[model samples]
Each structure stands twice: as structure tokens, then as C-alpha cells.
Target: MQTKLRSRTITKPRSHHGKPAQSLVARRLPAKRPPTHPGEMLLEEFLKPLGISQSAFAVRLGISFPRLNEIIRGKRRVTPDTALRLAHVLGMSADFWLGLQQDWDLWHALRSKQAAAIARLEPLRHVS
Candidate 1:
């Protein structure tokens, strides 16, 4: 999914040092689309391009074919163990795979009902 992000300046409360705090936040307000699942990315970008079958890749990764298939279908999450295996087999960093999964999971969580309640929460101020 393509998302067009625009930057907005946010001013935060001054710290003990009395310096004006400002940050440029690139908010994705227009597009609420969830991030691409790592499994889908793996299937499209790596498996298909490299002409590797799911079963063969699973064997190489030392995982069950069904587990890999579930991941490809977006029914399973890519755990740290799986991420490390993928990194070792595909020559990509484990962080790359885990980052994708984290993004996907966070996007969904932020849209959940629990997130609505969390959004109404106010941060506690320190009296230092």
C-alpha cells in the first residue's frame, strides 16, 4: 500500500532546562492502511523472485512446510526465532524481518479498541 505522509510540527512542554521543544512528526493521517506483512514481503520479494518453492525454503530454514505456508498466507506472525532463521537462510539481517513484523503488529494494535482507551490517557508529569 502506498501512503503519502506529511510533516507537522509539534511543540512539547518545556523541560527543566527551559528550552523550547519542537519536533517534526511525519503523520500518516490520510492513509490508515496497515503495513505489509513480512510473510507477504518474503513471498513476493524473495521467494518468487529467487524462484524458490515454499517447501524447499522451509527445508533449508529447518522449519516445517506448514509453518512457512502459514506465514506466507499471513496467518502466522514472524517470531524472533523465525526471523533469525530467515536472516541466516536469505542473507538478510534478522532486524529487517523483525522490524517488518513489528510494524505490521503495531499498526493493527493502534487501530484496536484498546488503543482508543490508551489514547485518552494523559502522561504523568515528573515533579523533579
Candidate 2:
């Protein structure tokens, strides 16, 4: 099973005020909804289509069925160890799984109520 990954170079457009426009990441984020959880991707893209039972896949991954189920249900984050195991079994790079998890995490973090305070933080100026 080959998954085609596409890479693109994004050009940042400038606003009329000469400031950089919203980033590609920002544009892709849904306004009122969280992005697709990585677990959903794993279930939809790999497990169901491949007809792999959770118990069997968990055995193959050398993990417990509950642990695998938690991941599939989005109740658990895909850690580095899980990513590595998934890569070894799925033939995809660990980075792919980790990246999806990161994106999901960052999107939620940015949308939280504290995000406004985070945005207000100023960078320290360097002493030349």
C-alpha cells in the first residue's frame, strides 16, 4: 500500500499594509472545527480499507489492544515510540505520523482561550 505524499512550496503574500499575509497553515485550519485527528486517518486510511482487526493489528504492533484502541479513538497521542512502531509496520516514515499529531496538537493549542495571551507575548530584542 503506497500513500502518495505531496510537497509544495508556499509563497507568502503581502497584505496592503506590507505585512505578510496569513500563513498556509492558518488558512488551512478550520475556523470553528478541529482538523482531522491522526487516529481518524489511521482508521479510515489504513485499518478499515485493509480489513485489519484492531486486536490483530495491536498484536502485530507489539502493543496492547486497549492502547491501540485508545489511539484509534483519539483518546491517546501518538508518541515517538508509537510512531516508530507504526512506521515499521506500515512502511511509512515515523515523521508522517508524528507530523499529523503535531499539526492536530498545534491547531488545538492555537484555538484555546489562552491563545490571545500567547499572541500578545512579545519577543525579546537582541542587544547588538
Candidate 3:
């Protein structure tokens, strides 16, 4: 008999913003939403604690210094591939990085001119 391996998904109980037991449906927006970039967390939480320099960490991740610098400066977004690299080196899951990027993007978008325009858009149909 052959054994079957299955993958499982684990959801975090708390968000980085310090909410506990965050529900999936009707996601709660933070009381005072501050768009925090992943780069800030990466620098303060990971790099600072690990004592890893930006240039050195870039070499460890097999990426260029300028690229890593941009990421650290919040000028660049962390893609899935970059998330994987970060996960490999930082001993964290790729989802963590992606989630950070997503949270920041959502918060930023909510305050953009495009969001105001989008608010004017009406729903196509009501299926309910």
C-alpha cells in the first residue's frame, strides 16, 4: 500500500495589527489604519534582530543589492518569488510576506484617488 500525502492550510488567529481571532467573513478593518509596509517590518523585526545587513542579506537571498535596498525602502513590492526567498532565509512562511504586502496594499489603496473613483461604481447585479 502506498501512503498519500496531503497538504494542509493553517490560518493565523491574529493579524499583525494586533487583532485577536480575526474572522474570515466580514473582515474587520483596523480602527486606525496605518499602511505599514513590509519593508519596515522586515528591517525592524527580522534584519535588526538577526543582525543581518542589507547588502549581506541580499547576497544570501541571491538578489542584487539595489533590488534589496528598494525593497527595504518600501519602493518595491515583495512578489511571490521574493517571498519564497525571504521565507527560506528568514525561517518564516511565504504567506507571511505576501500577507504583509497585501495588508499594506489594501490600506494604501483605500486612501488613493482610485479608491474614491471605485466607490462611485455600482454593483452589476444582486444575486442574493
Candidate 1: tens digits of C-alpha lDDT, residues 1-128: 23233554323323234653222123332235878899999999999999999999999999999999999999999999999999999888999898888878766765667865655556678989
Screening candidate 3 with a backbone cut-off below 3 angstroms (N, C-alpha, C), the clashing residue pairs are none
lDDT of the structure predicted as candidate 2: 0.78
TM-scores for candidates 1 onward, in order = 0.75, 0.76, 0.73
Of 2 and 3, which scores higher on lDDT? 2
Model 3 per-residue lDDT tens digits across residues 1-128: 11222442333334334554323323223437755688888999889999989999999999999988898899999999999999998888999899888877766765677854665556578789
Ranking by lDDT: 2, 1, 3
Which ranges of candidate 3 are over 4 A from the true structure?
1-33, 126-128
Note the Cα lDDT for every prediction shown: 0.76, 0.78, 0.74
lDDT, candidate 2, 31-66, per-residue tens: 567877888999999999999999999999999999
Measured with C-alpha atoms, the lDDT of residue 43 in candidate 1 is: 96
Give residue 113's lDDT in candidate 3 (0 to 100): 75
Q: Which pairs of residues have clashing backbones in candidate 1? A: none
- Give Cα distance to truth, residue 7, candidate 1, Å: 12
Candidate 1 residues lying further than 4 Å off, grouped into runs, are 1-30
